[model samples]
Target: MLFVAGSTVLGGASARAAEQADETSTAESSPIIVTASPLPVRLDELAAPVLRLDREDIEASQASTLGALLADQPGLSESSFAAGASRPIIRGMDNNRVRVQENGIGAGGVSALSEDHGVPIDPLSATSVEVVRGPATLRYGSEAIGGVVNVLNDRIPSARPSGGYSVSGGTSFDTVDQGKEAHGALNVATGNIVWHADGFRRETSDYDTPQGEQFNSWTDTSGVSGGGSVLFGNGYAGANVVHYDSEYGIPAPEDPADPVHIDMRQTKVQLRGAFAFDSWLRGIDFAGGYGDYRHDEITQSGVVGSTFKNKEWEGRAEFQHGAVGPFAGAFGVQYRDRDLSAAGEGGELLAPNTTRAVAGFLYEEMSLTDALSLQMAGRVEHVKVEGTALDTATITEYDVSRDFTPLSASAGLVWNLDGGWVTSATFQAAQRAPEAPELFSKGPHEATETFEIGDASLNEETAYSAELSARREGRGYSFAASLFHVSFDDFIYKALTGETCDDDYASCTDAGGTGTELDQVRYAQQDARFYGFELEGKVALLRTDTATYGVTGQADYVRAKLDGGTNVPRIPPMRIGAGVYLEADRFMAKAGFLHAFRQNKLGPNETETGEYTDVSMAFRYTLPEQMTGGASVKISVVGQNLLDADIRNHVSFKKNDVLLPGRNFRLVASVDF
Candidate 1:
């Protein structure tokens, strides 16, 4: 099955490649704007593969969350435990391996620690989004070793009164649930001060699955943001604050006898400010932010209550100047203080503690030529962890404190080859320290029911990666491809030893005993590597003054191997997707299909999941301009398990019963006033 699905995806990719080649033979030049840089540069001048999602694309997709929207991109996958909980997986790395940024600053808090937690930002209010793939993301930080997803919003007040408001309502056929959302913003300029304010609210009811109606898991979210800026001579300064809150849950099984239920709620607040200073020596940019996040969960049986809280503060300052001889660059120092604590209903601390990180970085981008550019960056960070641990047997407490200093660096070169083609290559060395839960937690994970044991002596994980990419943009057509290989030293993974405890409750701690425990699954410095390539392009087959038709397709393949003759776990197989789109003056339509090949090659702790295909279609219509109103209606139908194939995302952990939302349908209506 795996071989057959793989061949089908490859065949489809070949056909698309051929079509792209033909389109490029007689294409015209299309001007592509580049915003991946601090200053906007043309696409032809960039050496990296940056994927942009504009407002039009965002509206067309009509996804509820950023994670779901990114799932359409090549080389990206998402896993969700419920409608409100989803996380992105790039290449084969996720969690702490990936970074999610808001504007240009790190989205501080605890979203990176678990898969069930949802990102706080609302995508409906975003103006645009960009994904920096591969090692090129090293400029952000070592935490982005996998990649970077940056969400951009117009939180800054404009110099003129310019703003819009939107409201939407939708429902799903399977869940019989209703959803409503509203957002409003106003920006006005007066004298030297520009003021801006925005607010949004969303609410949804519990949804239904194939088995039965999932209950008690409704979502309610609300946020308000405001900012003010003042222009002083050649510099400007601004301050902004945003507060958000959400509550949701996951229902137990259909049978009332199951006796289990899970509920979660989160609240977040962020305050930030930036100041720009014009000086004779160099221009300086200073920014600082503070964030507070709290998560509370309630479970029906084994674990009555579980709660986690995280509070963080960060500050950074950078200076850049282009007049310096081949030395136009930015250097900044950053400090983050994080406090995390978790406990169960019995007052026993499951994971306790506080950690502090101080980091400094230097980044330089030099133009060797009009067609060639070089980038060099490095960061040094010191992390300190302090906590108290309880010894189960002795019933005694132990005080622990440890500090680690990790260093990371990267270099890259981009070249604009003649003939509308561009290429870039990058190499990076990165490291990640252990998270709080990984070092001090003990007991069963309420979500998975696995007994977790922490190792205080764990060391940092490190890796090196290299990537090469090329892109071509022509009239009515564009194409891009990237290849990457990453090698890891002391990669941390989780494994289950085929042993059971004497009472089947606690795992044996002695070396000679037979028991199962989830610890930093240990392994010597083993060599592991990941290689993948992605190709995506679009071509306009026919175009007229009032109408256009186009076809787009993308495919990605990834393979991972370990030196000890083992297959890497949790790696997604090859995937391919294609879509056809047609647009008129006021009407648009699109149909697309995505196929994921079966993955049967099992690692020591993995199992096989069958192949699956999903199909979706959408249509939209715009009202006439004379009415002084704009409204759109969209309907989408998705078919999962098109082949009625059974699949599972995880062998031991998640039995995700791949029911494919089973012929689900949704309709949404939006209006602007």
Candidate 2:
């Protein structure tokens, strides 16, 4: 369910209604930006399933990792490997299949390289977040065949406030991890120029679970950004710079004595511009970014075991054209270049390589009638990868190079039925080129605790997906549901060989000794199929000017298997959730229960996970007007796993050793100025 704030009860309100409320409350309310499109569109008008989380939602979720924050949402789950890092698993697909972005540009980092590496963006400072679930790959890229998560921030001022200056700050504390966080942001306008600045700091101790404290799960993060923009007639130009640093520990090393923590830092710069013209062309939008990121893994003895670096740059330009014969569309071009390197005592160059790519895309929407719409989109990209590797025993140099031209296309239709109901159907054909790591990796990786091996001969992965969805929004209730299926021609994934290896491959080849005792995994390709469905609905039980009450129900399930009949490893289990909520002019409260069913289907060397339920609640109140600042002030208390349930995520590699946080409470306070 979407969020509602202030005054009259908005129980069971849809996202469209919530957005309308914001506009009524604030004249300058911003619309949800479509990073993949030339211009922004209303959430309700889109054919695909799109989830938008604003500042309030971010504050309410306050999870240690991005995946954890969205895990409860329909068709989403977290690969809860550690408190330090977790990546979102969408429709049972993750890693290279899902794309993470910041303000429409790729987040240039090694987060996708391993589950232990965190995404560089900080949610605490984000203004909003958006998720696109179907056919977005037509515009974003084939890497996003599963989905796309875009984090949006106002580091580069886009608009001036009613007043000359605006400032806001907040603080929050979480009990489970003994975590403290503080953040502040400001925007100042002087004529046509606007300046923006923001900063945040967060620190946490080891988190406690129902069993006990999860040792070495602490984390520290801090960052700051500054930017400015100039607004001219019908256009704006802006640039921003940011620096982020973080430290966190990994608790999955086989030997408790082994060192396993990461110290990471990144510096990024971006520029954006848009212009409107009074000609056949409607508008033009452009964006570019450059990032320098690196991380060092430290052992318990203070030794730098491995260091990884990523230097990347990307740019995009799009042109919007006026409708021609009932067809409205935009065309664009994109370019990206990246270099990855690693070095250290334990560092074996998993993929010391350089990747370069350029692409062009076209998107169009047609109004078949006042109640019907059609959308078509397509993209073609040319990519090249070059890498170098050395044999462990022979010490021989090997050069690897691969090139491919991938194409993606999608078509969708939205029908507005009677009774305030709408339905959509989408079909897409997408292809993904092999990533750098999948093509050149050849050594032991500490993050995943495996003797890594890549297949340079792997073929491109091709997928055909289809989705059908329906939604209804009425005066006091809302409902939405979707069903999707995808078939892959050659899915590239790591498969366990059921063979044990020492710290290095040498142990496995030894004549008389067992190696360090780690599983050996090899990159392989196989035909696969995945299908899923998500259903959600809310109903109002009572409504009045002073108070309103509502109930919500949601369920999601996914099944994935190789063509040979073996289940996919680490797939999310079926989940169902229900909740109750109440809201008034100054107060709001909600409680919910979610249950994940036991997963019995297993792949080779995989274990089953038991079922579990999580209970959560939260209450918020608006303070009285005498708070000094000419803005609203609010306080909130939130609780998760109120029943202290022992929870284990099957999708996590460390599920056997680590449990999720338990019985945690958070105190949150914030003000708008």
Candidate 3:
């Protein structure tokens, strides 16, 4: 049994899952689908490593931000830039290398351009989340070079509810930040039509750290979504619209006295449909979306200092067929267009730009035998970017346009052993085109306090990677492990230039002008290598019809360096954790602790972070059905950082100035009818 999405082993034993399996495994039941894939197969058939969080797991975490909710998972970390601006970091990769998506579509936002911008999608809207790494990333695009974080909300209903309608809602409160949230969702079905609607609101004051209150570190956000679907005998058509808004403050070390924050608004619309065929073509699925996003950085005087906006649209179609004997697969084609601009303070950080790309991908699998299978995938994309670049020789801005054709491919072997054990080995070669900001950014970015420089001549980045994974699942025990290595040619990175500047880049390169103000960094390329390993295991010591006891342990580590041995910036340190728990028919309780080692692998001009221990405890209870009129009611209390240790995220750029929230407790209540 497993309390995660998709496979029992690949999704790892999450923190709460470490307690006990809530339900028994069933071989006759339908397999959980991994929506990240255009044409997903069964769990044991996957050739790459993955981690997933189902609805139950998500409820227990109840984090305010998506990044914070997943930070404890194996092989995952967050930028921790601020209370509202954190983003997920996977396999020691962040920024443009990791893709953040929603419901099988790209979450069109500017969070990747800088660490201070927050991802517009909230976990409150997600029913589950998947973290996919390794060769499987080819299914998306080179943008997911490191990995992909796909948040599945299913706003559009494809099937009817058990009853004519179903309703669920809840409210939560926390002590650490004095935060409160309210959310509700409804689904209704009428004959062949299904409808869905959901909304949420959240607000929080400054949070308390181990030292004291963190000033200007608060968050306020809300969002609503409505959708419906029409189901036919052989297929279905659906559409959804979403609106999100948020405003949060940033704790800038240099301007601590002056409050700075971001005000954001985003609207997204999506349309999708599926059709089944009787000919050689099995079926076809198509989806498209449009998004308009904008965020304004406000200064102390309440004036909009810098405004960033992005308008984008994308569409893709996937066709499934078994044209080749003994082989089944899907082919997909995608097109995307994006326009972005910045205005007001430090507006020159990046001139107005537009990026367009078209791609075609193929995935095929063959069962060599009942116990062995082969999986192959390949993708080719053509990309073009328009922006402005600094003409170093001429010392002025110049119009620039660059084009690239990137190709990626992978091959893997999946083997099913005896006693429910599975293993996979994969090799991939991927190429990525430079993003707009990576090739055209100039002038200063106030959020990071850096004078940025980009090179239009930058070439495509390429990676050659290999991965080996194995897992075993049984009634009483489970184990999972993965090891991966990646070698990159011309890896793109920002290099510090040991110079300082003010509102502009002028005088930054002068010998006497260097100061403790904004630093100067230029995008550069170099050969690099990254390697990592993850391990998880759990054992059920006692089991009964109504009660079970278990113990769980997990460990993960990653190392990355430039060809000359220089450590990569903002890499998460290794962590080892273990826990114990008990489960009863109506009550459950669990406790866990994780210890992070001291991070001494310092990047250039960076300081090392101290080690710390994080401890958590939780208790849950469900009311008797007789007391709720056949409805389900649940209450839970969760305690985090029970150790009250002063913690700093080694993977954050603001780690030196900002400390993680201190000891805190949260209470939640929910009902399903």
TM-score of 1: 0.83
Clashes by residue pair, model 1: 28-475, 175-208
lDDT of 1 by residue, 164-254 (tens): 2223333333223455655655555566666667776767666544554455545676777778666444445577787767665543332
On residues 287-363, what C-alpha lDDT tens digit does candidate 3 reach at each position? Answer: 78999999998877787878999999989887777559887777889898999999986468888999999999887
Which regions in candidate 3 have their CA more than 4 angstroms from the true location?
1-31, 36-40, 510-516
lDDT (10s digit) by residue, model 2, range 569-661: 888999998989998998989888889999988878988889999888889998877765467788998888889998999998888888888
lDDT of 2 at 259: 48
Superior candidate under lDDT, 1 versus 2: 2
Which stretches in model 2 have alpha-carbon errors above 4 Å?
1-29, 349-351, 389-397, 509-513
Q: How high is the lDDT of residue 104 in model 1?
A: 54
Q: What does candidate 3 score on TM? A: 0.94
- Alpha-carbon lDDT of model 2: 0.78
Candidate 3 backbone collisions, by pair: none
Best by lDDT: 3
